[model samples]
Target: MSGGYDLNLFASPPDCNFLCSVCHGVLKRPVRLPCSHIFCKKCILRWLARQKTCPCCRKEVKRKKMVHVNKLRRTIGRLEVKCKNAEAGCSVTCPLAHRRGHQDSCPFELMACPHEGCTARVLRGALAEHRQHCPHGAQERCPLGCGATLGPVERARHNCYRELREAWSWRQERSRTLVLGLLRRMREVHRTANLVRRQLAQLGGFLEEEDAMLVGAPQGEAEATPEGSMGAEM
Candidate 1:
């Protein structure tokens, strides 16, 4: 290969297969501990910070005697020029010494919460903690009546108030409509009574005029009229 070591250097070596268990990254600056297990110095340091054990055999390696093996560092240095996240958009090639920093801020790194209405970003190391708290992030409203924004903890309270307000508003509107309908019906009844009174007044005026005409008529002629005959019979 164009790089220093054969691309297949660690390809199932017959006697000893060498690979960094943590990243599977080519091990550079290799260090062999008293336990006869080897790991890249940087990888071992990070691994030991999290856990104190050999990556390959799970043997306990003390923090003190991790000797520097110079040959492994040179091999890893040459292999570092390949993209760590080739599937992502990272085209930069550098030594393995810089791979950790590059991967830390890789743009293609998967980070955000997958939950709806949550916008929290999670790093690979902190995904578990992020998922636990992300559900409590701000949630969107239902948008039908009173639009209220609330966090997960307060959603129940917001929904309760919203429904109550809608119910109260509906009752108030119905009451107003009922009152107005009753007033309209009452006005119609009053109008009909006024019309009946006017008609009765007209009928009374006609009766008085007839009485006056009967009194003015000749006495014998008035006595022979049907109304005067009826009055005499009564």
Candidate 2:
């Protein structure tokens, strides 16, 4: 009778699963129900909210059966340490359960634009758009004394000064060529005047020579003819 009707025969200990089905982390704040199944309180609560089932055996457990155990809370409390982002200069230390909340407001979590010359710093969510139109990003400047800042859209305008400078230099060169041509023409005129003066002097010399020759011949012929005629007439 003692072996067949023992009152303690129907009692069995609850099964404690050491692993969380979702995160695979150690079960802290273990929760248990009348079905003799155990799980972490936080993990089971989240799982129950999605579907009321035993995380270990997948047994249909009611959401009301989920209970928070103080022992597991104490265990998780001790595991809380400095945030993982502490290496990135975050000085806050919080529980793993609250780490996500702490990271949202973490000052050291700021991200700077990766684009060149962009000094803008923003949250992780806004980094994409900030990089798109980064005002301080890579830009060019006018090299031909335009003295203005330029972006990709202004590159053509920025180089306009080069063409303008070239045009001005061409005009200056044309003016210089014109002045040189006029000077060359004046030199030619001066040379022509000098040649004409020399020719005029030569012509005057020839004329004087002809006049003397004519006068001398006329005088000699007159003298010779007069003597002959006088003899013939007598």
Candidate 3:
């Protein structure tokens, strides 16, 4: 983390007391030592890591002896500061506490270019201008879903008509394959129907034979009854 706010960012010079002795910048998250000397929390902690003496008075300091000065921190927060991107054309001036918020949306902030294959870092405000002349920024893709990505150098040479023709040919081949599949399915269905018809014709012949036997059975029984009565009478 930054030890303190940049001294140059302040609208006016801060009082000497508000400066960290270790970092020589405005106190940030100020912490008072046992000797009553204050410095930025980060600066003091770092100084104590190397030597156990206060940066201001050379008094013996310990990590546990540090006391946070919330009032001083709040005071520093209220100081007016220019945007960090001021040199990049940002003119925003706000309280130290609000600097992060302003910087988040500052157009002059540096950002990596969004286009792939370009490693240039550019100010957000100048990205569009950069893209206009970037060798790899502007891109065009084949409209026929050919999966071809064209950069600025290849854009003029791109052949959309050829892509369209290839796409149409692929669709025609796919349609022919689908039609053949359907025709095969229809042939199978016709064969199944013919087999069903043949089975029904065989079943009809069996039913006709059964019906003829049923019709002749009653006449044969009647003729036997008359002969049996005449024999009984004799």
Top candidate when judged by lDDT against the true structure: 3
Query: Which portions of model 3 show Cα errors greater than 4 Å?
Result: 140-234
lDDT per residue for candidate 2 within 121-179, as digits (tens), equals 77665676775567764474565566666675675455666767898999999999999
**Angstrom error at residue 103, model 3:** 2.0
Better of 1 and 3 by lDDT: 3
Query: Candidate 2 at 228: error in angstroms?
Result: 4.9
| RMSD, every candidate, angstroms | 18.0, 21.0, 9.9
lDDT per residue for candidate 3 within 42-75, as digits (tens), equals 8888878899898767889888878999998888
TM-score of each: 0.28, 0.31, 0.59
Global lDDT of each candidate: 0.66, 0.65, 0.86
Tens-digit lDDT string for candidate 1 (47-99): 88887778777888787988987776655554544444555555666665576
TM-score of 1: 0.28
Query: Could you arrange the candidates by lDDT from highest to lowest?
Result: 3, 1, 2
Runs of candidate 1 exceeding 4 Å displacement: 1-158, 216-218, 222-234
Clashing pairs in 2: 29-72
